[model samples]
Target chain A: MDFWSNFLINLVQGLTTTLQILVISIPLSIITGFILGFARVYGNKIIFYISTGISTTFRGLPLIVTLLILFFGLADLKIYLSPFWASILGFTLCGGSYISEYVKGAIQSIEQGQAEAARALGMNKLQEIIYIILPQTLIRALPGVSNEIIYMIQYSSLSFVIGVKEIFSVAKTFNSLYFRSIEIFTTVAFVYLLLIAIATLVFKIIENKLKIT
Target chain B: MISDTILNVVDLHKKYGDSIALDGVSFRVRKGETKVIIGPNGSGKTTLLKCLNLLVKPDKGRIWLGNIEITDPRININKIRRKIGFVFQDFNLFHHLTVLNNVMIGLVKVRKLKKHQAYKKAVDALSTVGLDNTLYHKYPAQLSGGQKQRVAIARALAMDPVIMLYDEPTSSLDPQFVNEVLQVIRKLAKNGVTSIIVTHQIDFALEIADEIIVMHKGRIIESGRPTELLSNPQNILTKKILIRNFRTLR
Candidate 1:
């Protein structure tokens, strides 16, 4: 009943931490995805297989499993990362693997003639990828990338399992102190709904504005 | 004095598994000459154009574009490739880019020209293909096949290639749309642009080619002026293919 007075500050703080994780993870995921996908398609056999193996390993594992391994396994190797950084690393690895598939698909979906024309024009391999291939890949991969972004928003809550004081973690505190399961979860549900709404709207605008000619 | 030789290929050989595509092919084209290659389907016509740009690597060959040995592993190929423009049958314009950017890409990216300079050259190339300013902003999907093909030609020509190679440029066009493309090639030939065109057009070949090279199975069966080849009938495959084509048109 007095939820705002008691829990509003922590809820907002949790949301801010969740967003911080997102900002760091999303860009990292995209760059990793592009590099992995490009390597898989065009790199020499060794690099291509390495990228393939890494992508497969990450994509095969569940996100929570990855988080646990990153968080705990690192300590065994005499490395340490805070729960925040661990979740960011885990989520990025997971997102990058999924996004890499999208990128590879986009690259492959493009007609081979496109690259041939670019090369025939005397553009080198790097120039071809930058001008002819990368632009089209971004456009083609938009829908897939945005879908991953949405998945990321929901999965950001998984950070709570790593002792991250993110959205669900804040909600858990409120649920326990208030002894009001229905109200606490309802508010949490609304927060998630609102996040999804904003994510969907932003991606829709981008996809419409930037769809391939 | 500039060497009259614009392109020279020496004993080019290529195969895909068991099938040989180009079998010991050799030829030379002079500056300002138009050489048309007439071949049946799957006779390595496209492969030959692709090989010229190193898109399809040959098993054995030496290709010289002027003094530059394109086949040499040491040379920077991108520099060599820029001087040799290639147009594909499918009009492989970048579908995501505007018709203008399609032309400007090589200029901006490969030539590293400033945007304004690239735009000016791109427009000039498009205008040469009879694509006016109005169509510059259009996408490939927005244009007719003829227009897309012209845009493709513009994209290639904007590079200012020393020699142009067309891979069955008109093969994908409708009967009604064929002349517009052929007409562009005709004008280019008349303007003394050195070019090698691979096509099924016997009529266009006779009209425009200074030398027509007929390929059969996988080798150059005959290479001569249209008048001489038609009059003398040297190779049976050349005679058969040309005669059949002429008969269909009439």
Candidate 2:
């Protein structure tokens, strides 16, 4: 009973850090994704090439390598960032690139006639995109973005490697001290499952609410 | 150049790769004149309308909306477009918005009308297109093809455009629903809404057209008053189109 209580206390504290990272990272990643996606689709040639390069470079690199470079490699270059900030920057860049691909695909799936109608109605290109196109694109992109968000949640554990005592890291510390690998790891897995299930439900509710009749 | 001419096209030409869409097409539409363009497929009727609305840029031509030369690069296309309404064949209503919002969007966004004013104009336009208040809150998918097209027309009309362009507006509709859209166009034309309509419905065109222009192979093959063209067609293609598509002429 004492072991369970101690583990639960550590679990709650670790979860608070994990939730903090997610709360900050998710919205930043989504904003980054939209900017990159919009540039790829409607931007001029130079902007298209630049955004495509950014998306490809980040998506091609492993998330661990990105986090390590951001945290350690940047320190060598005299650009120090806190472990928490480095993890956020890494996740946002990598996750946003993947999310951008989904956004590009969704934007393309919208009918050409839709844009033509808005332009014919005297909407400037920017107004047409914001008012006529993005609303529909976001709904189409929700499932893909939700998948990315789930991946980000699972990967948030990696921040523990950089000294953030999130759930997985806390579990590792407790297992080392008490040698209760089964109990500690099992609890961590459950925590991740719970987070993912909650995320899926939240995304589904959003999709349903925004869905075109 | 005529004082009454609201739109004029001079030596209009367009090409997509090797194929010519419009070649040396020219015409003038007087204020409140309903000009109907009839042609076989690939004859540039739709392209001509798109050019006048500046939706398609003409490779070689000059177009004037009133005294302003629209083909000039300095002209703001968006500003010109606001005054020229276009109703597409497929309706192209914004699926995400309600019927009322679809019409109200342009009025608010382009015309800068307040929400209440836009709502009033949208409802009036919807009413003019024969759509009742009951349909206002429904989405595009919830409406039938006819109702969707009516909403598209109301969306354009709510802008209070100086001229309206219809590009095969009823071609996608079921036969039973075609007359309803045509009736709206007929009513608008009778009220003296200047328009250029491209359609296969030659009979309806004859009824509303102040003058009918027949196009073939990217050129104006013939044009005249409805009765004159029916009585004496200058081009064989015109006679063939009139016979094939015009039920009354047959």
| Model number with the top lDDT | 2
Worst 10 residues of 1 chain B by lDDT: B1-10
Off by over 4 Å in 1: none
Model 1 lDDT on a 0 to 1 scale: 0.89
Top of the candidates by TM-score: 2
Per-candidate TM-scores read 0.96, 0.98
Per-model RMSD to reference: 1.7, 1.3
Off by over 4 Å in 2: B247-250
Question: Would you give me the overall lDDT of model 2?
Answer: 0.93
The residue pairs that clash in candidate 2, if any, are none
Q: What digit string (tens of lDDT, one per residue) describes model 1 on residues A46-142?
A: 9999999989999999899899889898888989999999999998899998999999999999999898888888887888899889988998998
Candidate 2 iRMS, in Å? 0.6
**DockQ for candidate 1:** 0.79
Model 1 CA lDDT for position A160: 86
